[model samples]
Target: MIKKRTRIVCVTLICSLLLPIQSASVKAADNNGSELSEEISSLADFEAVDELIEQRVDAMTDGDMSEYHELTEELEAHGCEDVSAQEVQELTGETSQGLLNSQIQSRNNISVQTKGLYSAAASNVTFSKSITNVSYGGKSYKVMKITASPKGRGTLFNTGSVTQKYNSSIKAGSLNLLKIVAKKAGSASNVIKLVSLYDTVCSVIRGFKSTTKVEGVEANYTWTVEEICSFIYVYDARVKNYRISASYNKAKYVVSMNLPYLKVKNGKSYSGITHKQYSDWISAQNYGKTDKAISCFKQGTTYNSWVYNVSMTGCKGKNIKNVYLQHPESAMTLGYWN
Candidate 1:
C-alpha cells in the first residue's frame, strides 16, 4: 500500500513539471508567430512604398502628369504625403532647378512648410522606446516609430534647401551665390560677389583700337574702351602713335614735350637732313637740360629715319623720346615714314 502511494506522488510531481514546460513552449510559439506576422507586414509595406516611389520616379522622367498624380496619391495613402520624388531628388543632392536664385527662394518656402509638418506630425511617430503594438487597419499591428529632434529637423531642412540652391545657382551662372546668401543668413562671415571680369574685359577689349589682345596685365576693375585708351596714353610708356613719358627734374615733376602739340614747342632739328641729318638733329635737341634727355637723344639717333622723324617731328612738343616711339605696337604699327 505504501509503494502504491509513493508511485502516485512521483507521477503527480512529473506531470506538474511537464505542464510548465508545455505552457512555455506554447507561449514561445505564439511570440514567434507574432514576430513573423509583423515582419511580413512590414516587408509588404516597404515593397509597396518602394514600388510606388519607383513608379513616381518613372512618371516624373516621362513628364506624365496623370501617372505622377496617381503615384503621389498612392504614396499619400501609404502615409507619406508630402514626399515628392522631385523634392526627394533635390534633397538627395541628385539634381536641382535650372536657376539658383529663384530656386533658393522657392526652397526656403518649401523648407518652412516641411519643417512645420515634420514638427506637427512628430508626436504621432514612435520614439526611442520599443513599440510592441501599432494601430493599423482596425487591428493592432506591431510597429516601430522614430522621432527626430528639432535641431535635426532644422539641419535636414537647411541642408536640403541650400544644396538645391547651390546646384541651381551653378546652373544659372551664379557660382558664388551660396557664399553670398550665407553671409546674408549670418551663417558665414564673408560674402563673395562673383563678377566674371573676363567677360567684361573681353567686351571692353573687343571695342578697343586693336583686335589683338593687349600686351599687359589685366586690370582689377572693369574699364571702358575710352578709359582703357586713356590708361594706355597715361601709363603705357610703350604705346606708339602717342607721345607720353614721365620725368622728375629739380624736385618738380616735368612732362617735357618734344612733340609739336600746340605749336608753342621749341626743339631744333637740322633744316636739311639725311641719316647724318637725323643724328645731328637729335643731338641738337634742347627739350630739357637734363643729362638723361641728352643721353636719350644721342642713343636714339641710331634708329632709322622713320623713328628719327617721328621722334623729331611727330613727338615735337610731347613728353616723349625718339626711342619711346620704337616700342612695340598693339594696333597696326603707325607705318614708318619713307
Candidate 2:
C-alpha cells in the first residue's frame, strides 16, 4: 500500500522536474496589444488553470468540468469570473436572456446586449492546505489542493470582436474554429463538421436598412432563417495567404464568431437592399396600416450553393430593424453587405 500523501507529493515533484521550463514557449505580449505581433489572448489564463489542475488533483473530482464550476464560483467571490462554453451555457441556458448588457439569444447566437463589445472584463485563490482523496484509474490518491493566486493572472475572460486565434484556430465567445480556418488554408477534407453540428439561426435587428427583397413585388415577412453554411471568406485585409503563421500577424485574424447584429439608424439604412431567392412566411398577421414598429424575420437565399440569411422587420428605423438574417457555419467570415 502507498501513503496517499507521499505518493501525491512524489508525483508532483517528478512532474515538476520533468516540466523544467515553467514559462510559455513564446512570450506573448499583453492581451491588450493592438498590433499583429502582440497579444495572445487567454492562453495565460488557461495555462494557469492547467497548472492548477496539475497540482490540485484533489479538486478535479470530475476533471476540468468540476474544477470549472467550482473555480468559477470562487472567482466570482473575488468579483471576477472565467467565461467559457460552460459559463455561456449557464448564464444564458434558457430560451433567451440578457447578460452583461448583451442579449444572449441562445447557445452560440448572442444577440447584442451591449453595443461596444469587442471590450473588457474574470480571478483568485486562497492559500490553504488540505489532503483530499483524488481518484485516478478508479483508485483514490490523497493529494493536496493547490489553488492559483488571482493576482498573477491580470487577465479577463472578455467579449468583443478582436481577432483572437491560437495555434491556428479562431475563437469567439465559446466557438473554436480551427478546422474552418484550416479549410481556407487549403485542405480538402475538413476536420470540422460545422456544417453538421449547428443549425445557424440568423436574425436581423434592422433599424436603418431593409433586408433582401424577394423576386415578386413585395413580400411581408415575420420568420426565422435557418441555414447550414460552410465557411467562405471575405477579408478587410489584402493578404495573399489567409493562413495564419508566424510570418503573419496572428493578432490581425480577428474573425469574430459572435452573432452579428445589423444595426441601422432611422433614415440611415444601408444604401442598398439585397434580393433573396425565397422568403418563408410564418406569420399571416400583417396589420393593415400604420400601427407600430415590430419584429421582422425574412427567409434566406442561396449563393454558390450556400445559404445566406435575409430579413425584413416592421421597425421604421431605416437603421435598426429587428429581423433575422443569414446563417453561417456559426464560423466567422467577413463579407461585404453586397
Candidate 3:
C-alpha cells in the first residue's frame, strides 16, 4: 500500500513538472516569434528612410526653404548629415549640386559601371557623393545625402547595366573599338577564335533557324547576343546588305531631350506602352545620360536589362539593307498608395 502510494505521488509530481515545462517551451517559441517579427518590422524602417531622403532631395530648392530645411533636420536626426552650402561651393565652385552622382542617380539601380567619376575634375562637370545644400527663400537645407548602395545591391557588376553594355561594350571578334557600333574587329578576321570560346571546334552554333515570310518579306529568326556575335564572325562578307533583327526583353536606356528631366523604365517594344507615351508617367526623373565610363547613373528601382537593337551598316554604301540590332526590353510595376 505504501509502495502504491509513493508511485501515485511520483507520477503526479512528474505530471505537474511537465505541465510547466511544456508551457515554458510554448512561451519561448512565442517570444522568439515576436522577436523575429520585430526584426522584420525594423528592416522596413530603412526602406522608409530611403524614400524620405528621396523626397527631401527633390524639394530642396523649390522656391521655399522651409520644407527643405525641415527635411534637413529630419535627415540629421537619422544620421545623414547635410553638407553646408559653403562646403558644396568649395567642392564644385558652383551654386547647388553642379553635377553629383546623387543628383543624376535618383534610383537605387545603376545601369552601367562608373569608373570613379565621383572625384572632382578641372571641368565644371562632376558627380559627387556628398550631401548638397541648396538655398531658396533666404533659407537652405542639405538636400543630397552621402551616396549609398541600394538595400542589397552593392557589387562591381551592376545588373541594371546589362542592356546598356550591349549598346557599345561587347566585342565580337575585334579588339579595337574604332567605330561607334561594337562588332567584329579588324575585318572580323578572328571569327574562328571567337567561336572556340563556346564550342570544342571553331564553328558557329546557331539555334532555330526560322525563315518565315512576314507580310511577303523574308523575316529571319530572332537570335541571342552570343548567336548574333557568332553569326557575324562566320558571316560571308560576299553576302553584303544581309539584314536580321534580334531582340531580348530587358532594361535599356532611353534618351529624350524634350523633358528637362525624364525617367523611363525598361519595357517591351511590342507592348506599345512607354513612360514617354504618358506625360503623367514621367516627370523630373533625371538620370544622367552616361558618365565618362559609359555607365548610366541609375537608382531607386530594379529594372530588367538585356541588350538588343543594334545597327551595323556596310554593304558597299548601299542603303538597300537596314539591319537593326535591338536590345532587351524590361518590365516594371508602379505602386500607388491610394
Candidate 4:
C-alpha cells in the first residue's frame, strides 16, 4: 500500500509540471501570431503610401492642376509635412504652375510683323526686300525676305511691295516670292513676273588657306575677311538676265560689282541658270576652277575666307587682288561687290 501511494504522488507531481510547460507553449504561439498580423498591416500601409505617391505624380504629369494641388495637400495632411511645390517638381519633372506661367508669358510677349520692304533700283532692275519675325523654341528670329517684283519696264518703274507674317520656323534654302504684273506702254496685256529670293547666314571665318596643282602648275589661294556677315541678292530679269549681288554688315569693306548676267531657260525659276553655264562664266573670269577666296577689312584686321567650293573658281595670277569669294545661297560673303 505504501508503494502504491508513493507512485500516485509522483504521477501527480509530473502532471503539475507538464501543465505550466504546455500553457507557456500556447502563449508563445499566440504572441507569434500577433507579431505576424502587425507585420502584414505594416506592409499594407506601405503599399497604400506608394499608391498615393504614384497618383500624385500622374496628376502632375497629366496637367490636372486641381488634382495635383489636392494630392499635394493630402500628402502634407498625411504626415508628409515636408511636401512642397519644389518637392513635387522634383518628383513630377515639371509643375502645373510652371507650365501655366510659361503659357501666360508666351501669350503676352508674342509680337510678329513684317518690318518693311526696302528696295534699290538701278538700270531698270528693282530689288525689293523685307524681313519677317519667326518664333521657335521660345526664341524669335528675323528671317530673310524674298519677294517677286513685276516684269519689264513698268514693274521696274513701279514700287515693289511685300507684307507677310509667318508663324512657323523658316528653314535655310526655303524660297519665298512676290508676284507682280508688268503693264507695257500702249498695251492692255500684262505679263506675270515671279521674283525669287534666297536666305543665307554668314559665319565668322577664322584662318583658312589652300593650294592646288593644275597641269603641273601650283595655284595658291588665301583668305582675308573676318567678323562679318554676308547676304545675297539674286534678281531675275525675265529669262534673259539674272543678276547676283551681295551686301555685308559689320564689315570694313563694301562689295560693288554685279556678277555676269546668267542666261536661264526660265528666268522665273529659282535656279534660273544651268550649272554648266554658271560655271563656264565664272571660269572665263580668269578665276581658277579650284577655290574662290574673298579678302576684306574688318576692325583694322583683314579677314580672308573661302566658304565652300560651291563652284571651283578661285582668283588667278601671283598678285591676286580684288577677288571675292561667295557661297551662293550661303551666309559666307567674302568680297565687296557693289
> What tens digits encode model 4's per-residue C-alpha lDDT throughout 212-264?
11111112222122112223222122311112223222111111111122111
- Alpha-carbon lDDT, every model: 0.22, 0.22, 0.22, 0.24
Q: RMSD for each model, in Å, please?
A: 39.9, 24.4, 26.6, 36.6
Best-matching candidate per lDDT: 4
Candidate 1 displacement at residue 6 in angstroms: 69
Give the winner by TM-score: 3
Writing each residue's lDDT as its tens digit, candidate 2 over 208-271 gives: 1123221111112222222111211111122211111100000001111332121122222221
* TM-scores, each model vs. reference: 0.16, 0.18, 0.19, 0.14
| Clash count list over all predictions | 14, 32, 22, 21
**Alpha carbon deviation, residue 199, candidate 2 (Å):** 19
Candidate 2, superposed: residue stretches over 4 Å from native:
1-13, 19-67, 71-115, 120-338
lDDT of 2: 0.22
Error of 2 at 21 (Å): 9.8
Q: Rank the candidates by TM-score, best first.
A: 3, 2, 1, 4
User: Regarding lDDT, does 1 or 3 come out ahead?
Assistant: 1
Minimum summed lDDT over a 10-residue window in model 4 is located at 35-44
- 92-209, model 1: which lDDT tens digit per residue? 2212222223333654744534333333322321111111222334643222211111112121111111011111111112111111111111132222222221322333223322
* lDDT for model 1: 0.22
Give residue 195's error in model 1 in angstroms: 42
Distance (Å) between predicted and true CA of 63, model 1? Answer: 1.0
Instruction: Mark the 10 consecutive residues where model 2 has the least summed lDDT.
Output: 244-253
Q: Which is superior by TM-score, 2 or 3?
A: 3
